[model samples]
Target: MDASSQDVARALLGWYDVHARDLPWRARPGCAAPDPYRVWLSEVMLQQTTVAAVKSYFAEFVRRWPSVEALAAADEGEVMAAWAGLGYYARARNLLACAKEVAGRGGTFPADELELRALPGLGAYTAAAVAAIAFGQRAVVVDANVERVVSRLFAVAAPLPGARVAIRRHTDTITPSERAGDFAQAMMDLGATICTPRAPRCLLCPLSASCLARLHAEPEQFPVKAPKKARPQRAGKAFWIERDGAVWLVRRPGKGMLGGMRALPDDGWSARANGNGTPPLMGPWQPGGVVAHGFTHFGLDLHLAVYEGDDWSSLTASEGEWWPLDSIDDAGLPTLFAKAARLALAEAGEVG
Candidate 1:
């Protein structure tokens, strides 16, 4: 490592020693080194999610399943439910498969980055993270934080995709010969707090003296990324049918939009729904309010369709469950479906 980068890393670690946020899974003194399983689970859940939101979910998961053995033994549906509100449904799905795989492999998570990357859904960055944080291996961990930090430190202006490689090369140099986990975590914390996307606290930053962006008095301008285009809204229809206090929810197909998650009855396709927008339900229907949801690729415009009949026994969907409204919170409905369910039930009650 160059003397300048070494000084930067040392300064940043010094700052982290005092300013690092209290997060779960951090190794503590003499308390059975943090479980790699917990570390792996938290990292998967925390991807594309903020630390504040991850805290509660992490606590809930650790409390529910204390170890890899317990998580491996858990039902897929239950794991999905526990991870419901935290978006990225696919991660939840992969989490189950990976847990099971790790358990079957003698309950030992691979310490080598190559072996970790070979696991299901473990990408290069994530593999590097697990290798460094879990086993103290020297590896480059480039998450959004590291990207922003590197972008500003050297003022790399190249667009992403092309820029990521250069940034990765830079990160590889300063990762250090030891304390790999703390260095990676320190970089993440520095990015989140000091080198934030907007209005970075440049003055308080430990590496500010050596930061290129700080030298130019525009640390926020480093690591230039292309602007995002406007998200197009796509339309869909959802059904709302209830009996007693139970609302009907069906398992979305294992492939495609919101795959494998619990959702309301819907027609074959989201838009037009086989034609005329009537979902997979029977009897006369009422129009519930439209519920708006956003996915990674496009926005969803889902119209709630409700059918209320006293002869509830006469109406049945192909495959679904009637979950009590009171207990529906535990059914692992994604945010989008949960919002739709609320609207549908409200409209159903008004018409009934």
Candidate 2:
């Protein structure tokens, strides 16, 4: 490493010794590393999610499945239910798959980045994070927060996706041969707390002396982004077939959008298209209301259709169960379907 890069790493680590965030998955600045299971779980949950949002979920997950072995033994449906409200349903599936793989390998996670990357659902970023933080390996860990920090520190003017290569190269140079885990965490903490995207606390930052963006007085503008394309609008319908204070719910097919989740029967809406399938039972279906939800790529207006007729014959023979209304919350429906359920119940005067 160059003298300047060395200086940056030393100053950042020194500041980190005093100010690291007390996150559940993190070991304190100088302590022994935390359990790999906790570290891996937290890293997966934190993808495209905020720390404040993930804290409760992380706590609940560890409480339910204390170890990687325990998680591997968990039922897929139960895990998926627990993961409700946290979008990105695919992560929950991958979590189970990875856990099972680890369990099959004698319940030990590999310390090498390459092995971690080979696990189901682990992308390049996740592998690097697990290798560095959980196993104390010297890997380049560049998350969104770190991306912002690096871009501002060196004043990289290239737009993201293209700028990532340069950012990773710069991160690799400063990553110390010792305490690499702490250094990685320190970068994340600094970016999250001090070198913020807007209104950065430059004066309080330890590396402010070396920050090129701060010198230019434009920290926020360093991580230049390309323009965002408008999200396409989609519309679909969900059927609320209630009989004797219970509603019909179905398990979605195991390999599509919101797959493996329990949800209200809908008109087959997907990421690529609007719902077009016919209702489960013939109409005399009343229009209850419209529930608006935003996916990563598209926006949906899911129209709730309440069955006004009492038809129990065909539905009983179909692939679903009648979940009691009082216990619907435990069904573990995805956020979109959960919203539809609440709308249906409220429309029927079951909930106030």
Reference-based lDDT, each prediction: 0.82, 0.91
Over 4 Å off in model 2, which ranges? 28-32, 316-318, 350-352
As a TM-score, model 1 comes out at 0.93
Weakest ten-residue segment in model 2 by summed lDDT? 25-34
lDDT, model 2, position 105:
97
Q: Give lDDT tens digits, candidate 2, residues 1-352.
A: 9999999999999999899899988876557768999999999999999999899999999999999999999999999999999988899999999999999999999999999999998898899989988888999999888899999988988999799999999889888988888898899999899988889998899999999988886898968888888899999999999998889999998887898999999898877798995899885877889999998889999999888886678886458999999999999999999999998888778534
Clashes of 1: 0
Clashes of each: 0, 0
How close is every model to the real structure, measured as TM-score?
Answer: 0.93, 0.96
Cα error, candidate 1, residue 157 (Å):
1.5
User: Once model 1 is optimally superposed onto the true structure by TM-score, how far is the C-alpha of residue 276 displaced, in angstroms?
Assistant: 5.7
Residue pairs in collision within model 1: none
The TM-score measured for candidate 2 stands at 0.96
Name the weakest run of 10 consecutive residues (lDDT summed) in model 1: 267-276
Candidate 2: Cα lDDT at 98? 99
What lDDT is obtained when candidate 1 is compared to the true structure?
0.82
